[model samples]
Target chain A: MSAPAKLPRWAELGLLPAVNLVAALLLSGVIIRLIGESPWAALKLLADGAFGSQEAVGYTLYYATNFIFTGLAVAVAYHAGLFNIGAEGQAYIGGLGTGLVCLWLGAWPFWVVLPLAILAGAVGGAAWAFIPGWLQARRGSHIVITTIMFNFIASAVMTWLLVNILIKPGQQSPESREFAANAFMPGLHTLLGKVGLAFTATPLNLAFLLALAASFLVWLLVWRTRWGYALRVAGQNPAAAVYAGILPPRVTIAAMLLSGALAGSLGLNELMGAQHRILLDFPGGAGFVGIAVALMGRNHPVGIFLAAVLFGALMQGGSQLSFDMPRVNRDMVVVIQGLVILFCGALENVARVPLAALLARLRGEKEAE
Target chain B: METYTLIVLLLAATIRVATPLLLAALAGLFSERSGVIALGLEGMMLGAAFAAAAASAVTGSVWLGLGAGIATAVALALLLAFAGVTHRGNQVVAGMAVNIMVAGLGPALALAWFNLGGQTPQLEGAGQRFLALTWPWADAARAAPFPGLLYAELLSGHNLVVYFAAALVPFSAWVLYRTRFGLRLRAVGENPSAVDTAGISVTRLRYQAVMISGVLCGVAGTYLSTAASAGFVRDMTAGKGYLALAALIFGKWRPYPTLGACLLFAFTDALATRLQGVALPLVGVIPVQFILALPYVLTVLLLAGFVGTAVAPKAIGAPYAKEK
Candidate 1:
């Protein structure tokens, strides 16, 4: 095989992702056309719907908050060489934690309930993720398979709990009672309104700020800490880590714990932040979206924030598009998500090879000049 | 007498329910045995289910639907091959992309074409579905007592796919252990370097395995839509592909053992359906959710070596770049 050409950092981080996004969008346009709609018109509507007004931006940010939590969750595990697909399940269990705290202490002040709720959510998510980590580390089972299994198990467990035990008395639907006003995560609009600043009410909440904080903490934990270095080393090369006296199994367990905790934070945004109660399927495929976010973001916190926002835009816009253009629905966004995964994750090198050649040619010209 | 009839009916229902899983497990057996992770089995099945249901609904021909399903699944498998075999990308990630893509694409396309909220129109005419075929002398044998119940209820009436699935286990066993192609396919999964040294193209063999798996998955999906139900429902596969994957691992990647695992899982599913609200005397009312989750729980335990160890193909999930 010939030696492969290399590209600069700008091309690596920026141009490559942009190329992939374009490829995904172009294909999405084809699907849109296949469904008998003009892709340009749809694109226009989508952009307008996502960013045309303050309310749209608020909803976009609201959705972005959930993506950030799950994206960080996935990124942490990816760094540890573990494919933790159990984020959906962990988020579900985490919501249960948040819900329990809120239901029991709904009468308490916001300050007292919020801290405990966050802690309970993290602990719940981490605990759920711990089993898969332990199994992979000690029992020789594949973490991917175990995590996928846990997602289903989580669904089943939640169903049983909700239907049999936790369903609000005399209610037919499988959901918990509403959390008290004190327990609700105040919406951003409401909070902003108190400061003499006016904004349209949306689901956007303080959890968006919480998501930003989580992203920064993850950056610190994954890049700045000694444990983070060990985790990265273990992920990149187990043999090298072992040679350097780092226990891979321990790192795997720790990474999963952190991943699960990050995923668990999703509930704070969706439940305490928006819905204000636990419900079935509240994760609503955000865990899977996190995979796409992490992949598109190249597993970086900064990249994740950008990718999460883009996806949030897609979510907000796609829903609006579906309302106007009945032919195109929210599933169109799912199709986009899948194409993004395909382009960014699976077929990542498709654009890289050609782009590398181009860069190598440019360098050759520069040398000759 | 009533209880005896119900037992026979339940056993028959078990066979019906097991068909799709058995086919899908065999499909995974082919792909994973060739060293490519078949996580996209769910996606392939879902895509084919929608294709089959749509074609059947449109053309009113079950055969066309079957053909369409196989073609769709083959196309998907080829995409998997391109990413996994040709590009040497992460097999798990690629497989998952296929799944997630189909999960959305199927529903989106369905809504666009049929406009029934991500569902195909109901298949009605006789030609649109694979109706159960009663065996010769089925009615004649129903007149007897025990023999009648066994022959007519337990063994006779089932769609063609169920019979094909039953016959497929022994056929798969023969092909795996007895055929030259099977040997090479298995060898490529175990050690592609050895296969490459022997002048066999690892890529071709892996692609062939994936294609075969895709066809089987297509049939499984077709069975779900055309035979098991009258129309395609959104997310109708409902993790059966995963269940089949679990069964594949539980069976230790062997044909007969995998069939047994499928049967066990199917029996549980049948039981879950029957015991949905009924309370038993000794066991009391078992949660249907627990029964539904049993297969996943058992597979995890099996993988953990709590019960027995399942050794995967050595070269599985690793991209083979030919040595210089």
Candidate 2:
């Protein structure tokens, strides 16, 4: 066996996030240069578009609301060593549930309808994910293959439901009718203005506050709860966890269910707060972006929240960038996100080797001599 | 039609449906057998489709287009192998990166190269298409009512690569079970350290397997763009490569069973397409999405219920490193 070396405190606690941010910026800069755009100009445009005005800040926060939930979903599963790749499908199912509830209970008050709709969404999301989770936990099937396959199945099912069943007749698009006014989240634009705190025209809502609350709850569960500790232990070493009498299959299943529920909450927020109806591609790419967020954050809740905000800014700014730099496609944002995930995942393995720390100590000793 | 005719028709549909999947599954077999999990097969197929369309448009030779597709896939496989085998990078992460890169790059390049947006210019005339095969005896059997070109066309009349895909089943089975090189390949997947100690180079063997997978994926991509369809469209392969990987697992990593799994999925897809117009009682009310979802739902069910004890090759996704 190899000797166990003491890890430096800073490397273990702080260096990773800083390194990821630096790597993300460098890669984004390189991508900008490759596309023949000036990096400084792009950065300035992004800053202005994301936070230049109170309206911009509100919009960024609005986008961050959905991402925050999805990021937590991914982090929860990662902590249990279950890669929940079916978040996209689960989110779709959640949106469907939210829509159906709104249609059925359109006369209900906002106080009652909203909570019931969100709960229904969570249940739908959990049910959608349970199939793959049960398969993996009970039969030892690979979660990756099952979840990937489920995404396609869910897409087809959702499309069919939208077109044939849920669609209001004569509408060609895959979408439902407008949601009841009671189902809508109270927009912060009017409320904040009434309170003399409004500085923007954007419509932030209760979902943003819920997103922050969800992140804090996740942080608490992961760092303090016994179940979370067991999940982490199982993730870190399944064989050892099994030896210690922890049922890995059960933990994996629970983690995946929770992940799906969180993803479902994102769909609820989008349906009730932003769009007020289910539309095709409503939660577009947020599920996939959550993967990058989880990776960039090193699967930590606080880290995922920060990463989600960064991406939310990029996405919100990317739309404005289209108007300013008409030649550059907004897809450059996707490329940047992909590069960050790639580098961050790769860096995780490299960082554990202590080569950088060893070199730093050696240089300091040489200087002393 | 009589029961015999119905049976024959079903058999024919199965073979035709299985062709692309069979080719892709064979590709998966090669990569996984070499201890590398190729999650990038979807990306490789997409790249090959684009390249084949561009080459065929420029050269006016379908054969040249086929070659271009294979070459492109092989180049991608080399990249995957380099990161996975040589640099000892995380195989899944590298594979995913390659996929994202291709998804982004393919459309961007198509826009720049073809100027047709996300599609290629369609090919014209029978000269650029695959010809069907016919049999004299089958034609003469009116009592038996054997399908003339239909029988041979379903089984053998495919483009050269379709035949190659069928041949790969028996050929791969033979190579894997009978050959010395196959033994070393299996050894490397099962125990790289043991193989390294036994004087075999793990890197070289793995590189060869991954390259072979690349070539096969390239052929599959060409078949999609040129043989199956007249032109390439954006994201034409969709998720077929991933489905083939699922088939690989469903087949329990065996050649024959994997081919069977491919046929099963393809048959369901063909059935779904054929059922689009029919309105048969209560089931007719079922949405097209339900039918389309059949294959994947069945795959999940089968994996969860029936294939209870499948085992992957040892060290399947682990990158091999030399000891200091």
Candidate 3:
């Protein structure tokens, strides 16, 4: 594969993302115009709904909390040179784990159950991902194909478990009963109010704090630890890593396991914190969205966090836009999100060409002078 | 139902369900054999399915519907070619982006055009929807017994699209292996630099491969909208493109084997459809989801090399770059 053109730090991190964002928004505007919607009105509505009030901001972060887990999951694997597209499946299984634990240990004290839920979530996600990792490392299966297949398997398993086994008697909906009291995550508003800061109630919960810790943990693992260095080394070049006495297969498994664990934590936010019940299709495409987040953020922990927030705003705001402008439906918001991903993930080079050329020209002129 | 009748029904259902997978796998075969991965086949198929349904509803012509579908898919194929061959972006990432883009665009456009919850108006009459072609004496089944009855009921009543999908397998196999273009195409995937040194345009070959892929996917989409059911629904492909990819890998990217894998997967699906709520000999009742998941689980097993090693094209995901 060709190495992406290396530009200055500002150009790489700042200029390119800015240019791509503008292009994506411009294209989205064109599509909106074609659909006969007022693009400007939609934009204003989106902004207001995302950030106009504390409650709105709280909801946005609530969504961001899930993205953060999936994004970090993606970024971790990305640094290790794995695509990890199975994050969606991993997260589903992870939620199943948490949901089961929450149901089984409903009567346990909060302190007794919380750690168990965390471990189950991590173990569940990691278990789902481990097969693909083992296959790629040991059996020569391509990670992309296997992981993609596992996603379907994961969906089927979740469907069967929820619809057939877990549904309450006489309940027609394919959902588990409301979770036990100990499983209820304290919402952000409540937690903040405990300290005296007035915050409105929203779905945002202590999981957001967990997400913050996860970001720091990712940063620490990727930048500050030897294990992370070996993993990154393995990704960059298997031959080089082997020469340096690193075991490539072991690194692959470790990276995938960690990535899956991070992704699985989404269950904690969406299930334990928000829905408080096992429901159908809870992952809701967040796992795939993580790919966009990772790509836009350049697979950095801080970058992933910011990108997650930006996407969270988009989702929260887009819903408001759809609500206010009847013409702009839910699909319209998806189109916008997809456009952003297309530009940022695949079409970034279109914007990069001119920017890189300009920067090279500037460098040449300075050297010549 | 009698045992014989159930067996016949399952076999018939298998062929019906296998058509889409066969078409999509063939489409993916073309793209992957020419050195490009096609994860975006899902998007292309979905776009075309929508276009075919919407156009047929408006035009009252199934042929025109099929044409619209192909055109839509070809346009997407061109975009993928642009991203992979020209821009040289990451292949899988570009594909995933295209998939997400179309997933959004299909329902959004459907909502705008039809206001029917991302579903097109049902294809209105005999002309708009492809009708099943019953062979002569197929209707004689009521008066006949055993062989003639089974033959008529099982073989005579599929839409013409199913036959076309089945025929394309051998056609693709011949075009992929027995033709001169096939020779060069195979070479390009393996060693584009060799083709480049031999003075063939690598980009053009890859583009051509992707175009064929698009047409095949378009046909698959048309069949979904016009033949399988009537009209387009959101996410109608339902990861069939990915399933086809799994089949391709299981087949080791070969056309004939690809057909076999598709058939196996389709059979499992047909079985799953029939198995739902049925009491088993040992287990009280099988969970339908587990049976529905059988294809993916099997695919994962095949991919993990449990069955055999699946070898892909050597330079499949790599962009063509001249050595400096």
Highest TM-score against the true fold, candidate: 1
The alpha-carbon RMSD values of the candidates against the true structure, listed in the order shown, are 1.5, 3.7, 1.5
Mind giving the per-residue lDDT tens digits that candidate 2 earns over B1-324? 575665566666767667778888888888898799878788788778878877887788888888899999999899788767876766666666666656655654555456576567887655554444444554445344555535543654456666778899999888887999888888888888999998889999999999988988898888888878888887788888888887887787789999988988887777676577678777654456677677787678767767455677897888886773
* Candidate numbers, best TM-score first, in rank order: 1, 3, 2
Query: Model 3, stretches more than 4 Å misplaced?
Result: A365-369
Model 1: DockQ score: 0.67
For model 1, residues A1-369, the per-residue Cα lDDT tens digits are: 122346688898899889999999999999999999999999999998999999999999999999999999999999999988899999999989988999999999999999999999999999999999999999889998899999999999999999998889999999998999999999999899999899999999999999999999999988999999999999999999999999999999999999999899888899998898888899999999999999999899999999999999999999999988999999899989999999988887778889988988989999999
- Can you tell me the CAPRI class of model 2? acceptable
State the C-alpha lDDT per candidate: 0.92, 0.77, 0.88
True-contact fraction per candidate equals: 0.70, 0.36, 0.67
Q: What is the lDDT of residue A185 in candidate 1?
A: 95
Error of 1 at A298 (Å): 0.5
* Pairs with backbone N, CA or C atoms under 3 Å apart (clashes), candidate 2: none
Error of 1 at A172 (Å): 0.8
Tens digits of per-residue lDDT, candidate 3, B162-208, equal: 88988888898899899989999999999999999999999999999
Better of 2 and 3 by TM-score: 3
Ranking of predictions according to lDDT? 1, 3, 2
Which digits, one per residue and each the tens of the lDDT, describe model 3 over residues A1-369?
A: 354677789778877887888888889888888888878887888889999999889989998888899999988888888889999999999989988999999789977888888899999999999999988899878888888988999999889888888998799999999998888988998889989999999999999999999999999999899999998999999899999999999998999999999988988899989999999999999998898888888888788888888889888998888777766777776776677777887777777877888899998999999
What local lDDT score does residue A53 receive in model 1, on the 0 to 100 scale? 99
